[model samples]
Target: MPAAALKPKPSNEPLPTQSTAKRPVPLDTPYAPVAKRPLPPGRPREWYVTHNRRLKAMRLAIALLDSGVHQPDQARDETIRSAARLIGVHPPSETTCHMVRALMRYAR
Candidate 1:
């Protein structure tokens, strides 16, 4: 709502009603350009690897879900890799593929 359309409430007036409450506004655009931000410093090497693996697994799992692959058993490495490709992520490692299946199993 435009600020100019609002009227000042008198001191004796009751609190604003639900009709005046804020509504969720839709975004003007859905696509966001990726930002290039550096990772936080001082993390252990193992931590970085695990963090990256988790992110890859999450993206792959969501893609599989969107493509109607729900069960962990149905998400074999080849299937997971194909999902990765469909989503434009690099082909994941065996460990990352295992993580993807683990994510699917945990979803329920």
Candidate 2:
């Protein structure tokens, strides 16, 4: 008998093809955190106590300055006093106020 007549026919099933493209993956290295925890819902604690007082004091001082109640050039001590009063802190001296103003300018 011949070799062709002794073998069965192969089936017409499809063969699986593999992809050659590289897939992207996220880096697994650890990184330092940059975000802070979000504040809780509702009014913040600082708002009622610190922030409110500070804003009121600043507004009072600015109003006084703008209304010509005190001269800006000579009222550094007064401004600091008014701010301290609004915030319920001890009134700072003229020198302290000058330092505060200079520090504030530098901070910005």
Q: Looking at candidate 2, what is the lDDT of residue 7? A: 95
TM-score of model 1 relative to the true fold? 0.67
Model 1, 9-104: lDDT tens digits are 557444566453355433333323346578899999999899889987998897788678999999999999987777677899999999999999
Clashing pairs in 2: none
Positional deviation of residue 69's Cα in model 1 after best superposition, in angstroms = 0.1
Best by TM-score: 1
Q: lDDT score, residue 50, model 2?
A: 51
lDDT of 1 at 103: 95
Q: What digit string (tens of lDDT, one per residue) describes model 2 on residues 1-108?
A: 999998998755434563423434333332233355554558878655554454434544543443344544555766667655644556664555565454444433
Regions of model 2 farther than 4 Å from truth: 1-75
Task: Estimate the overall C-alpha local distance difference test score of candidate 2.
Answer: 0.51
Error of 2 at 27 (Å): 44
Worst-scoring 10-residue span by lDDT in model 2: 25-34
